[model samples]
Target: MSYAPSTAAGKQTAQQLADISRTLYERGWMPGTSGNISLRLPDDPGRALITASGRDKGELTAGDVVEVDALTGLASPPGQDRPSAETAIHAAVYRVTGARAVIHVHSPYATVVAHRATATDAVTSVRVERFELLKGLGLNDPTSTDLPVFPNWPEVDRIADDVAGHLAACREGPPGLLLGDHGITTWGDSLGQAKNRLECLEALCRLLVLSQSELHVSRA
Candidate 1:
């Protein structure tokens, strides 16, 4: 699972991916092998360097990186171990959105909020307004942004399709979505940006939950 060598672009190298995973794990966004991250190879846009499946993200190392084709969903360099089971969802996202990196996490806030929305078919879209942190999302004008939430499905193909459809309908900046009762999926132009977006999303979800609870207590 160790990378052969560092590449020129500095994006596809194994160490970079490992570092990003460890950072996310420390932030508590990924716990108990509950997340995956991938960055597109800078030289070969058609390939991605991703974290291997079921590894403890907190202890991720260079040996945990694997290369896979972005188009065919096949691991490259032949004989390498399989990427994460959710690789299909990642590949589908890259194909539809042209994002350079994807981060999926089962953070507590996102999981709770998603679970609350599980009873319905319509996406639970969250709109964050009047919060200075909203600026972190990089929306076109920063007025307000609707973050779409999709229903969770066991099949990757179905989940990918719903995600793709939501992104297409929204047609806005750096689209990210949540899977009901599952987790959050976010992307950006690079690994850093993607990580930043995930952080913002998780924080916003926490704030939303807290605000609602406070309102309920005040009313009672």
Candidate 2:
């Protein structure tokens, strides 16, 4: 697929993306360059400025940003370069929610929860209950919710389709979706909002992991 360069607004969003990517990477949430971020142009919702593949997100620049077809997640104008492989999932989030920015992170805690959710037939979702960070996700303060989880598919589009289906059924939760053995996808109406949601969700996941570990220890 091909990609076009970003517009002026997208350039600013691109810079913010680079900044957040580095922060997340430093936190070990995006190790191995395993995360991706994108934002809808301020003037166009159908086109998105996405990170280019294989770039060290720690040092991303405006030049590393490219525009992609928001509906299909393919690079715009047809070219040799490609966006992140998970770009399709970002497209799905925008299509289903009308979001202007999206982020996917391969966070250790979230990845662990995702894998454990799908590693068995017992549960397919994780619960976020009575956590202070729950408020950060726009949920009721101290309320409980489910984080929808799905098993990973070799084909990214197939996973996107599944996420779209789940989203069509339920609009609540953490405002994000987790892929088994993969990571989390979150979005917002703006790049900063999207970044904040990703950060909050990752923190929530970390809390869950720690609490669960303590539970296991107590049980033992």
- Model 2 steric clash pairs: 2-75, 2-76, 2-78, 2-79
Residue pairs in steric clash, candidate 1?
Answer: none
C-alpha RMSD values across all candidates: 4.3, 4.0
Error of 2 at 17 (Å): 2.3
State each model's CA lDDT, in order: 0.76, 0.75
Off by over 4 Å in 2: 1-6, 119-123, 140-142, 213-220
TM-score per prediction, in order, is 0.87, 0.87
Candidate 1 on 92-158: residue-level lDDT in tens? 7888788889989888887777776553455566555666767888888677676666767777777
Clashes of each: 0, 4
